[model samples]
Structure formats: C-alpha cells, structure tokens
Target: MTHAELVFVPILGRGHIVSMVEMAKLLVGRDPRLSVTVLIMKLPFDSDFDSYTSSLAASVDTARIRFVHLTCENTDAEISSASFLTNFIEGSKPHVKRAVAELVDSAGSTRRLAGFVLDAFCSTLIDLANEFGVPSYVFFTSSAAFLGLMLHLQSLQDEHHVNIAEFKDSAGELDFPSFTNLLPTKILPSIVLTKESVRSFLEHAKRMRETKGIIVNTFDELEPHAVRSLAGLGAPAVYPVGPILSLDGETKKKADGSCGGDDIMEWLEKQPPSSVVFLCFGSRGSFGEEQVKEMACALERSGHRFLWSLRQPPPQKGQIEVPHDYADPTEVLPEGFLHRTAGLGKVIGWAPQTAILAHPAIGGFVSHCGWNSTLESIWFGMPVATWPLYAEQQFNAFQLVVELGLATEIKMDYRRDFRMESGVMTADVIEGGIRKLMEEAGGERRKKVKEASEKSRKALMEGGSSYLSLGRLIEDILNNMPLT
Candidate 1:
C-alpha cells in the first residue's frame, strides 16, 4: 500500500465528529503512509463543526487529512430528528452513496480506497463498503461498558422478548448481561426508554454486528469486563484505542474560530492546586429555572471555590443542542447569586472544559457524565459528582458511580420520568453531593483514578496493550485489503 486512504464518515454532532477527527489525526501521526478523508454533513444553518473542523485542519500542516461535505436535499428535516441520533445518517444515505461512488470512480490508478471507517451512526453504510470490495469499521465514541450494554440489550430484546419500555412505567433492578452494576430503571440511556429510539437503536444494533470490525474510544484498564465481552462478540476484531483524546489542553475550539478562554485560564492559575470544583454539562445539557436556582443555593451552602458553565433550558419547540453564547446568568439564575459568589466563583457562558479539566487547581468535576467528559476526568485523575441529563448519560453515570467507583451520584433518578426530566434537585441534595465528592475522607477516589490514569497513559506508549492492539488492527486491515 503506497498511500493508503481511509474514509471517515461522522454524524452531525459536536462530540461525535470531534472525536473522529482527533482519531484521524492520531492515525496520521503514527503511520507514515496512511491518510484520512472525512465526510461532513451540511445542515440548514451554519454548524459548529464547520468552523471548528476547518480551523483545526488548517493548523495541521501535515497534509495527511482531507474533509469533504456531503450535501443533502432535506437538511432541515434531517436535523429536525437529529435527536434520533442516527436520523441524519438515515436520511442522507443517497448523498453518502453518491459521494462514495464518485470517490471510488475518480481515484487515480495509483491511489486505492484502503477501507471505510464509519461512526456508530453510519452503520447502515457497511453494505456500501462491501459493494466496493473494502472493509468497513464502526468507530464508537463512547465507553466500552455502554457498548456492551447496548449489545446485550439488543440480545434481550431479540431473544428474550424483553420489553425495554416496561422499565418506563415500572422501576426495578435490570437483568443486564456482562454489566455488574445493579442498574435501576431510572438510570438507563434516555434513548432506551423512548418509543422512537427503539427503531433507531434496533437498526443500529443489527448493523453493528455486521461490520467488518469495530474500534472503541476507551482503554482496556477502564472497563476490562466490558471490553472483554466486546471481544467475545467474535467480530473481525474489536480495537480499543483510547483515552484517544488530546491531553495537551486542546479544547474543541468554538465555531467562531477562536480558542476563547485566556481569562478562564488566568483565573485558574490564581487558585491553589486542587481547590476549585469545575461544573459544566456537555454541549446539549441545559437546566430549567428551578434547577438553576437550586444549584445556586447549593453552591452557596457548600462554600467551595467553583467554576460553572451554565446555559438556559432547551427551547420549547426543538431538539436539545448547545447555544453559541447564552444570555447573562442574572436573568435566569436566582437574584444576587452571581454577586454573592463573585470572589468565590467564576461563571462563564462556555467553559473550555478540556483545558479546565487538565488544570491543576481543579479538584472535582460536577458533570453530566457525558462519556467524553467522563473519559477526560479519568485521564486527568479527577473525581466526579455525576448529574446525568439526557441520551446515554444516565448509563455512563451509573458506570462511574457504581461500577468504576470513581464518582458520586447527585441525582440518579432525574430522568426516570421523562416529563420531569428537567425537574429541580433540592439545594440540600446538591450541597451534600458536592461535599461528598470534594470533601471525601482519605482521597480514595483520587488515588484510584490516578492509578487508572497512569495505566491509561502507559497503554498508548510503546509495547502497551492499546498500542499493540491498534498495531494488530492496522495489520489485519492492510493484509485483508482487496487488490485494486
């Protein structure tokens, strides 16, 4: 293979696309002959990914990566159901098919399509890869534990005739396979309980089994059991190449084309090491006014140095997504809250999460337990107080709190009743949760996470498990590549 090329197709979400691109950068950095081509999906409005991807690509002078946008006819309709997770990939199949055909047809005599790397959402395209006589791999931007649970859930639904929706009206312990945690009905992924999600997830589950191979953005040390189960699925291969994140303080740049957090960094430097608690939900997370007020009261009662990245509740009409810049906190939060906590706290529209989590002054994280945030906290050896909002976050939180024992739960049943998903958590609960996470005796969590962090770093170095596994995956794909 002279100039091996891989096609990466990522869905229309910030976390998903960013992880895929960063993985591309890593593959290019490690392999001299490899190159990656990313296919981006265009939306009705200017997307956050548009500026972020273009900016990041410009800084990398290696010429090893190229991005192409796949334009579709019904972008608005596609985005309308973006919460369905795989809807864009479903709606844009025609566009993706056309783009792949063009690329395959137009490549010169010397260049060859090495393989296809698809996001979990792009699983439906595996057949297209077969049509072109190339292998297709599904890249999961989540933890191995969650992946295992989803696979098990599919088996339960298919074989045992388990009705996942029954958990919605009733609450009890779940009989999940390969998952040691005693999962409550309240803590499943938001998708598992929704009627619409049933179809999307089932189709995705089936496609997952049909791929040539799979890769996960997690390490072996983090979830030995789950990763082991995934390998036992007997795929072409299951490669674990992660903590595959930028630990060097590279925040996902804002869509406006700026790093945008010098002031936050300067403030962090002023605080003592491990003194501040950083609170921020993931991109789509937002809270109702009641929850905001409760959080304000909790911060006051806890009397801890804090940095909160707050946003307004989701718009009444549409899906949950991050606003570029939200309005002032005084308007939405309780009166006098900002002023009372002025010297003791820092509140920003959007906190540079990757930078802040890597900071020395950050002792704890008050997170929505998004997998990216969860993995980042793990990489930096930070303890977490989990508050899951939506999607698969509840499941991630369960893993952190119960399975991994790396975090404390703020509210486990917050999303059990979807109608009360944004309901308030009392100031008492919030205060106690923060105190439990930040002021725990003996620092056992910090010690455990630090040890795990060390193991994760070593896994990416020479002769490490993750590094060796990735080498095997590359060799398998190259050896199996069809002759042009």
Candidate 2:
C-alpha cells in the first residue's frame, strides 16, 4: 500500500482543536493507508489542553494519529484585541513551516505528503502551504450558513463597497443565499459590525477561495439549503462531513471531576422521562450577577424541572474571560433561590453537556447556539431555546428560530460584547420563553428535531452523504500528493 500523510493545522482554542482532531480521527479510521499529523499551537494566556490531548493520545493508535506541539513565541500585541487570533496564527508560520518540512523529510518516498488542512482562522498559512508545493483544505468549525454569510458579506464589501458598519443600528432585513428567510440586521453577529473583526473575517473568506475544498462541520440534511447554496457559489468545493463531536464525555470527566458527571447523571436518572430543561452555555459562556439572578427568577416561576450550568465571570475585565464555578451558588443567584427550587432544579458548574443532552430526561436545551452544541442537540433530538452570547451565536439563533423553526427564541439579539454594556434580559422575557419552549416539547418543533436526528445519524452511515463526502475528500488528497 502507498502510505499518505495529511497535516492538520488547527487554532488554539479547545473547541477548534477538538473538532479538528475528531475529523482527523474519522479520516484515519476510514482508510488504513492514510495517517494524520496534527500541529498544535498554544495561546499565551489560555487554559491548557494538555490533559485532554494527553488522554486522547493514549486512547488512540499513536502511529496513525500524531499530535505535534509547536513552539510559539510570545508577541507584544494586546491579547484582548479582536485580531489576536489572526495575528497569533500569522506569527506561528515559521513553526508550521519547520514542522511540515520535518514531516516531509522523514517520510521520504514510502509515505507521500498529501495536503494541509487549515483551520478557518488560520487561512493565512495557505501561503506557507503553497511554498511547500502542497494543496491546502480549510476545516470550517461553524455552520455552512455562517460560511455562506461570510462569503456573501465579503462580496458586499469587495464588489459593492457597502460599509457594514453603517448597518449597526438598522432595523431592516437582508437576503442571503444560504438562509431561506430574510435575516434581520439586529440579529447579525456582533463581530460583523466591528471594523477590525469584520476585516479579519472577510480576509479569511477571501483566502478560503484559494483552498482545494472547505470541510464544514455540519451534515447536508441539517442545512440542505445552505449546503446547496455553497455548492453554487463557485468558490471551493464544500464537503459537509460532520456532526463531528466528542460524544464519549471522557475528556471532560478526566479534565475536571468536579464538573459533576456522575452526580448530574444520578439526578437525571431520578427524573421523569423528557421533563427536565437543560440550560448550559458553551465553554466560554458566563454572565454577570444581574443576568444570573433573572435566569433564576424565570426558572423558579416556570415550574419546570431544570438543570442549569451556572458559571461566574473572570475576576478582572478587559482580558480573556475564563468562567469558573462560584464558591456558593447563592452569591450570584437570587437569595433563597436554590432552597426554593431544590428538588425541581440543579445548578452546577461546568456540566457534562453531551452526556446530559443524550439522557432520556432532557426535554429541551437553552443553549448559546455554538455550532457543536447545535449539532449535539439535533443529534439527541432535543428542542432548543436559543440564547446566544458572543461570536456567530446571534446569527445561529436567528437561523434556528426564524429560518428553521427548530427552536424557540429567548432573545435573538442578546450579546455580551466586552467592549460594550449589553442590558440584562429581564425575568418575564425569560419566563415567557421558557414557558413556550416546554409547551412545544412534544409539538412540531420536537418532531422536526427527532427527524433531523435520524437523518444526521444516517448521513454518516455507509452510503450516506457525509460518508460519500469523506471518501471524495480522501481521494482528492491522494490525487494531490506531491510526486517523489
């Protein structure tokens, strides 16, 4: 057999790295002749992914899937700036170049160097891949809808010269090729309105056109319109091979036992089937005292069984926010709230989200609309109440609530931008949203999610859309292999 090697370059965050690794795993598992080399980059002040990566390394076959940590040099640039990720990835080009050179040298003729898989944020590295005479593929970690939106917005700026900043407060709806429904300007992601952030995003979108293909972390059944729209865009060929998730929950258990995996499972087992509403934000999701209090008030008034993952914001501001567990839940929550809703609700920090969503007792999800969380909810057939915070989440909320009708909207425009002060969402609004979500638990929305869940699973089976896409991707890699 002619061995082939593909190099994967993922961004520094946990979400991006994990998803990229899962994709690599799927690739190697599908073909014995292929192997993957993941080049890991570390952010200066972020939480370490050592334990998680170490655990994964031990469990998997080391020969097929290898992780190489690059030596990243610190820069004087401001860590909290919007362009931090881009700048960091750009600076690490030398390390990436050296790693790829070493891999090619060691492989010789027995294993041919196939291609480079770049993260969405790491598009600048495409130049380096070109330097080494290898094809590059982008691994987009968000929805295909979001990818289409990025390309659309890039066209708007490049061809039409439209200033997106002018639409900061516009109350109008705009049509995009990816979405079936018109998107309201109010629900646009907070990042797009900012000059610096949008510039970075558009730059990436433009560079994405130069890649061999873009692999999105979504299934075609879940976003048929978006996937089809992307195919017609004349950019790069898109491969929708996903619902790629870390479902085992072992990493979270090993990383932090205090995340309460066993305890949460025990509590869920005691509850009636399809009765508890699970409220968990993504890894970086957290809120202020006032917002936390209102959430408690709404949960108490709704009279529904609930599991809330409440995390406290970092002690200082103007830096990267790393939310931690509150010493006492009552400090941030309403006074006597825990005692009042003792049997009905359980508030813990750092929940095992995948496990919780998979449980039979979980009826609905109040999520931040992160792509991974959205896919997990769909995979488990849970109805969602969209409550987005930061990044592309606001746009995701709009897609879920207005476009797909798969989720009830808590607030499509709510954001927690560090640069500005967003108003606290009041208790009545949250209570109303919660009431609507629980009422539709067994209704049309639930039916749609269940059907999507089935399709999502089948998409990965042997003759499914994702399975075929992966095969095509592997063939493309082999065809692009550099001649000896």
Candidate 3:
C-alpha cells in the first residue's frame, strides 16, 4: 500500500477549524494508507493543547493522525487593532508565511508534503504550496452562492458602480444580471461592504486565483447557479462536500477525551417533535442590551417554546441587560428571566448546535446566518428564521430567505459594515417570524420551507449530487494528488 501524509491548516476560528476537522476525519477514514496532521492555533486563553489534541487522538490512531500547535500570540495590540483574526487567512500573509515555514520544518523528511487543504481565506497557503511544489485545495467555508457573489465583487468594483465610501448609504440596486439582481453590494460579503476593509478583500481576491482545487461545503443541487459560476472562475476543479458536520450521525454527544460533555440533547429530547425553536448567533456575532431586551420581549410575546443561546456579555463599560420583567431560563442567563419562563423556555450559554439542530423536536432555527449554522439548519431539514449578525451573514440571509425561499429574513437592510455591531434583528420582527414559523398558523410558510428541506435531504442522500461530489473529491483530487 502506498503511504501519504497530508496536513490541514485552518484559520483560527471555531467554525473553520471544525470544518477542517470533519474533512480530515472523512479523508483518514476513506484511506487507511494516508497519515494526517492538523496544525491548530494556540490562543493565549487556551494554554494547553490537550483539548484539541485529544479530540483527534480519539478519532484516529495517535501515530497516524497528530496535532501540532502553532504558538502565536494573537493578542498583539496591533493585530487586534487591525482585526487580524477576522481577516487572518486573507491578509496576514507575513504571519502565515512564517507559520508555514515553521510547519514545513516540523513536518520533517519522512513524508513528502501532500496537497494542502485550508480555509478559503487562507489564500496564503496557495503560495506556500507553490513554494513547496505541492498542490493545494481551498475550502471556501461558505455557501457556494456566497462564494460566487465574492468572486464577482472584483467585477463590481471594476465597473465603478460600487461606491465604497457610501455603500452604507441607500444606494438603489446595482445591476447584477448573472445573479438575477439578487445580490446588492449592501448585501455582499461583509468584507466587501466596508471602506476600511476593501483593501483586505481585494488582496484576498487576488490571492484566491492561485487555488488549484476549490471545495465548497455545499451540495450542487442546492445552488446550481453558484456552482456553475464558481466553475467559470479560474479554479481548475471545484468540489461540493457539504453539510460538512463533524459530529457523528448519532443524536447524543458522547464524551470523547478532552472535549466536554454537554447534555443539550437530553434537554432537547424532552420537547415535543416540531415544537421547539433553537436559536444561536455563532461565536462572533453579538447583540447590544437593547436588542437583547427586544428579543426577550418577543420570545415572551410569541408564547412558543424556545432555546436561546445568549451572547457573551459585551466588553464595554455599560453592559447590556435583560428587561427587568423578563424571566431567566437558566442560571447562566441574567437574573429573573429563567424563573419567569422555566416551563416555557431554556437558555443555555452554548449548546451542541449540530446535535440540537438534528434533534427530532427542533422545528425551526433562529440563526445569525453564519454559513456553517445555515447549512446545519438545512441538513437537519428544519426551516429557518434568518437573522444575520456579521460578515457574509447578511448575504447568506438574502440567499436563504429571498432567493431560495427557504427562510424569512427579519429585516431587509443591515447597518452598513458596522459588521455585527448593527445589533440583533428587532424583537417584534423576531416574534412575528418565529410565530409564523413555529405555529400551525405558519401553514403556507411551513409548506414552502418543508419543500426546501426535502430538496436539501435529497441532495445529500445516495445518488445525490453532494454524495457524488464527495466521491469525486476523494477519488480524483485527494487520492491522486502527489504526497511528498
């Protein structure tokens, strides 16, 4: 048997890292002769490597799959001031250059460096792979439609129609014939929407052209137009392997060394099927005090069962607080809200999102529209109440709610590139959408969304478009790529 070694480097973020891990697990399981290494970022707050290292060890033999830590203090004031973490994979070329060199040395001579798979924003990895004469795969870490929208951003700029300074201003729709005029700069990826951040986005686009192979975590049938559009871009090959969840298909979160055991599923199981709404606003999106209060009021008003993932408290001096009259659903939530809504709701700090979404009882998702969360919602065949929080979330929301007819957007316009700081979707709006999605009165909405859910399931099943893509990706791209 031929032996090969592959390295997976992910931009440091919860969602991106998780996706990389899933792909890694799938690859190792498919090819016994292949050895894999995962390079994980060492954040200051996380002083030990046990948590990440042990998870991989549990999945694969320690000898075949290993974890290496890249010790970088991401807290450098300059890096933080420049928002490097948010833009790390795209703009921080210098840092990535050094990091890659260090990794190459650590990898040693035993295995030839095989083709590399990295987050889409990690365009610098393309250069690193070229330097080593290795092929590279770029994971877009977003919807295929969103990737198509980003690829067209440069064209939008070249046309001189996107006014970066005034993108936040009420500019009437710009023409995008390729997109059915569905995407507006205001609704494009958040990176493209900001005047201050345009340079980083341009750099990212320029670097993306270097990818030899591209992977999007989406099925072909889900966004056929976007998939075809991506093919038109210079990418030699594009693969859609999605609903790329890392969790086992099982509904419970069994404790696997070093990872915490949370009982979110146990709580979810008690609820009636199609009776509860699961709400989560990814890791980075946050709501101010006012928005939080509004959501509490709306959730209360809707009189529907809910499980809300509260935002971590803001770092500002004046912290946001829940309404005085609101009931606390858990000790983790602020004071009174739990006691008031004990029978009707539960608020957890962070639930096993994928497991919860896959639960039999979850009827709908109230999401921040982060790409990973959006896909998981669809994977579980649940309809969505789209509430965009940051970056490309608004763009994802536009596709899911308007173009795909799978969800209802809480608002039409987001606060201009204030990014996630624009605040949460208004509570009254949230209440209305939730009511329409969760109750019997939501009949028409349910029927339409249920159709989308069916399509999503069909896309991933046997003989499904995504299943074929995964086969091709493994057999054609991953299996054939030369390993050093």
Candidate 4:
C-alpha cells in the first residue's frame, strides 16, 4: 500500500518538537500506510540536528518517519524580545516555503502527499500548504485551555480592539471562555500585557483557527471542559490525541539516570517509598544563583528526602541563546549547603525526569508547571507544588492548583524575569507548599491525580476517546486524498 505522507513543522522549542515527534511516531504505528516527514528548522545556535535525527531515525522505522532539516539564521540574541519570537517564525517562511515546495515537487517520492501538521507558531506554513493544494493541520503544543485563551485574546484585540493594557490594572477577571470561573487578570499571560506580543500571538491564533484541524496535546479526560470549548467554538475540527504519553514505553522513558547508577537514584532507592520529593524545571528551567540558595534553604528546612536536577539560569527572552552549563551543586549552591543536605537529599546536574516520575520512591513534585511536566506528574499520579516561571506556565499552574485541585502553589506571581528581580517564594513558603502537597493534603491530591491518571490511560487505550480521535484524524487524512 502506498503511504499517505504528512509533513510536520515545529518551532525550535524542545517541548514543541518532542510532542510532535511523538505524534508522528504514533501515526506511523497506527497505520502502516501513513508516513510523516518532520521538517526541522535548525537555528544557528542549535546543534547540527542532522546527526541527532539520524540517531532518532535509527531507533524507528525510517521508512515510515524521516526528519528533514532546513538551516535558518538563529536570531538567538532577539529571542528574548517580544517581537523576536514572531520575527523568528515568520523568518522561517521563505526557507520553509522552498523546502516544502521541493518536497512536493520530488518526482521519486513514494508516498501520496496528504497534508501538513505544523506547530502552532508555524502557521505561516499554512499558506504554503494551501498554495500546494494540500490540507493543513495544526498541532498545539500546549493545553486546550491555552488554545481557548488564544482565541479569546485575539477576538478581544482584533474584533473588539479593546485595549489589552486595561487588563493590567483591572481587578476584573479574564473573560476567556475555557475557564470555569473568573481568572484574575493579573495571572494572564505576560504576552497579553504588551502590544507586540498581543499582535503576534493574536495573529498566530487567527491563523491556527483557519487550519483544517487543530490537534491538541491533551487527553479528553484531562481537559474535558476546555476541549469541549475548543470543539464547540466552531473553529477548525478539534482532536484531543494526548496525554500523548507512554507509561512503560521506551519512546517516553529516559535511561537509568533514574536507576541506581546515579547518586540521586541510589539515594532514592534507599529512601522509604513515596518519601522523596522530586524537583525539576523544564529543560530551559533555571533559577538565579540567589534563588538557588533560597531553594537550598527551603529543601534543607523541608526535612524531606529529595532529588534536584538543577541547571543554570537562562538568558533573557530577547538575549543570547547560550545553553545551560550544569555546575557541581557544591560549587553553585550555597557554601556548606551540600554538606548540610548530604544525607537528607541528592542534587544532580541533570535528571531523567520520566524515570524519576515513574519511581516508586517519589512522593511529590516541585515543578515549574510546564504542560509536559504537569502531564507526566499526573500520568504518574504524583501531586505537585507549582512554581511557574514563564510562558503560559502560570495558567498551567492554575489549571493544576485551582481547576484540578491536584497541586499546591509555591508562588504564581513569579514572572519570566523574576530571577533578575528576586525570589518570589521565600524558603518558608516553599517549604510549606512542599509539605502541604507531600503531607497535609498529599492523600487527597494523590487520589485525584490517580483517578485522572487512570482516565488519561483509558482515554488513550483502544476504543477510548484519545484513540478514537487519532483514528478519526488518520481516517480524515486518508479519505481526503484523491483516489489513485
């Protein structure tokens, strides 16, 4: 059978790339006649992704899914600027248009061209898909709630021309449709606060709604209301094909950094079951040196066994894209801090997050509340103490703490640049939040998350909501093709 070929494009962000890659893997596995080509836009600062993709291809059936690369100028220095993100993605259009056109023109291409499945930020490619007479689908790397917020914000700006600035001081709640109750205007995305961000994000939202379908990275069981809101809004077709996650699968599991070889895992193995607290931010997650000191203080005072994968502070959004250099905890942490917490916890440079979350030794999570991490924690039935740093993480934190009631909050007010300012969470409050999730209300939170975990599992199982949605998507792609 000739495979139906779908091209997927992702913004250079790690989370966006990861989920899309997983989606590609799932598509090929579900239908042998479906093939995916992921076009990777390589930034100058990003390492040669060719070799990396080569390795990834070796791990999978390369005939089914292969990665293509397009080298684009890395606007590293500008990524921190509000307009830089807009500029970066928009800049990829010409190169992407050419690359995609070449793929469409290839005479020896064995697969039937189906359509495009692109990252939310890469909506610029939709025009190219249209020009090529191929269907265009969009994949949202975040939650359905975030999707609703995007639409609401765009309508608020474009349709109403209501000043987004007014929300800054308004004690009134955000009128975003996905939320069950009023959302404090203050906790709205930082992007909504500025004109450039508003214009760019609204543009992305508008383009997203124009796609043939919108694929969200959340299971129906996890975000029923938000998912319903997305579908009911009369936008492009909505498919909830996630918690696109795996429990025992190798595709989702990182190696033994969670097993006994690492000191952190060794310590975890020795600790009593469900006693150790796991703290990790996203791959780009970092805290200031001063904030790191405070975290040390909090961990020490919490008197909880712990595993911390600490990385250096990230550059500002518009600044250089220098990567994190993991330092010895003893060197970067407070003097004598490692010695003090020696027996009580373990601090490592990097962690295999999936492994740690799966370990029975883990009791609670202190996290930055990125959706991937949030989903992983929920998938494992572990409760969390949220500490949001940037992007829509505050909203994710809200979804966990307020909407789902499965997480406690350390501090939601900490903005993207809080490291330059100061620690919003004092050691006391940090310790308190950790304890509340691990001790005071740990049982209740665990039960809620476990139920969510089961539902999320079933949603992806055969004949379940997520599985059916994915099947429908594949069928739609296949049916849309011209009969050979």
Q: Using TM-score, rank the candidates from best to worst.
A: 2, 1, 4, 3
Model 2 misplaced stretches (Cα beyond 4 Å): 251-259, 419-421
lDDT of 4 by residue, 1-484 (tens): 6778898998877777778888998999999888888888875554534554565556665577878777665665454567676677767778777877777677244777789998988887798888877889999989999899888877777888888866766777765678786788767777776655677777889998888889999988888788888755556899999997533323322354343335555667788888999898886677767678878888898898888878776545434343464645566688998888888888876676887898899998999888888889888888888988777888899888888787888886576542122234578888888888778543677789889989888888899999999999999899887553
**CA RMSD (A), model 2:** 1.7
The whole-model C-alpha lDDT of candidate 3 against the native structure comes to 0.66
Clashing pairs in 3: 111-484, 112-484, 327-337, 327-338, 328-336, 328-337, 328-338, 329-338
Relative to the true structure, candidate 4 reaches a TM of 0.92
lDDT, candidate 1, 1-484, per-residue tens: 4667888998766788778888888788888767888888765443565676676567556777888877743534534353434555667777777887887787777457888999887788887788888888899998887787778777778878988766777768875554776788777776677665665676676678887778899988888888887755433478998877754555445558666687789999999888898999877767777777889899988999999888765465254445545667787778888888988988887777888988999989999887888888888888999998777888888888888888888976565223236467899999999998889745788788888889888998989888987887778767877777
lDDT of each: 0.78, 0.86, 0.66, 0.78
Which residue segments of model 4 deviate by more than 4 Å? 47-55, 74-77, 107-109, 246-261, 315-323, 418-423, 482-484
Residue 153, candidate 1: alpha-carbon lDDT:
76
Considering lDDT, where higher is better, how would the candidates rank from best to worst?
Answer: 2, 4, 1, 3
Clashing pairs in 2: none
Q: After superposition, which runs of candidate 1 have C-alpha atoms over 4 Å from their true positions?
A: 72-87, 232-236, 248-259, 416-422
Error of 4 at 134 (Å): 0.6
Clashing pairs in 4: 79-317, 80-317, 80-318, 81-318, 219-242, 219-243
Candidate 2 residue 322 Cα shift, in angstroms, is 2.6
**Which candidate leads the pack in TM-score?**
2
